[model samples]
Target: MRSGTDVAYDDVNELIATATRLMQKDAAPDTLTPDDVRKIGEELDIPARYVDQALEALARRREEQAREAQVQERHARLRRVRLRRSAWVGAAVLGLLAVSGLVVRNGLTSTLSDVARQRAQVRNVVERRESLRARQDTLTPGLSRDAELSGADNRVAIEQRRYDERAADYNASAASFPTGWVVRLTGLPHVLPLSSEVSTW
Candidate 1:
């Protein structure tokens, strides 16, 4: 003979097992009528009132589980969106940096090229003046003072002065703020002072 406690325990186990089987069968909560509860109670040999209460409790538990699953799914979707946004932001930042680097590189290259061309012009002028001096030395002293020679000397002097002024202006601009940063970063050489002889001429 089963004691009252054993009988109650058996009834509770039967209720849990039957509820689990119904849930596994995908029983819809709304479809579980009072007749279904009565049938479960008869099968489990438990009272209809207890079965009805258990069915209601099980339905609430299933609803709560469904709500929790939805919440978890929403959180997962939110995390994926955040991760995608982060990736886009990171790519944008890198692209900006790459473009900025290219701009800086191109600017520095152009500036240096201009400076080199200017320096070549200055060298050519200096060489021309040296060639003229050598020719003057080969001539008689009177011929050196001829109108043509004097005019050539004057023109060379004017050209040398103009070159010096231009060079000085360029150096000043490069040494100033903004441009100076580019100059320093590129390691550009500073313009040299004009020869003292050019000033006297």
Candidate 2:
């Protein structure tokens, strides 16, 4: 009679050989039946009880493997969904940033344009005042006392004052929040106050 260890070893060998043959025949392990185990056991001269245990063990292993595969597949699907969601979120954030940059650029351009226009007006007023003074200097000394000339000088002074005030007001507005950022970025200098002296003949 064979020792218990020898019998167990022989049974394990028979099981391995039977499984190998089934694999060579393209039999799926998950599709193995108790009848197939019994047939293998009978052919190998293994006990019926042992054959039943081996069948149960094989079924349990197959079920565990199936469950594991399902869990892995579920994890892979969830990971793909999360990656897609993250990509969408990133794209939305980038779009928002691009829109915000365009809005800021437009605002800065508008502010700078207004500042340039105001400066040009102020320069024109100064040039006109200078021209008037030079014309008065060329007039006859007797004509210098004329009331019409005096009134014209006064009007020019008032207009100069008005232009200066407007320039000051624009500067103040540019120095305020939001618009001030544009001023700093463009390196705009402060607008000087116009001379208070009126041109007289």
Clash count list over all predictions: 0, 0
TM-score of each: 0.50, 0.53
Per-residue C-alpha lDDT of model 1 across residues 92-155, encoded as one tens digit per residue: 9989766765566476566556545655665676667677778877777785347656776676
Q: CA lDDT, every prediction?
A: 0.69, 0.67
**lDDT (tens digit, per residue) of candidate 2 on 15-97:** 78988988878855656567887888889999999988877898799999999999999999999999999999999998976
Q: Which residue runs of candidate 2 sit more than 4 Å off their true CA positions? A: 1-32, 139-201
Span of ten consecutive residues with least summed lDDT in model 1: 192-201
Worst 10 residues of 2 by lDDT: 192-201
lDDT of 2 at 60: 96
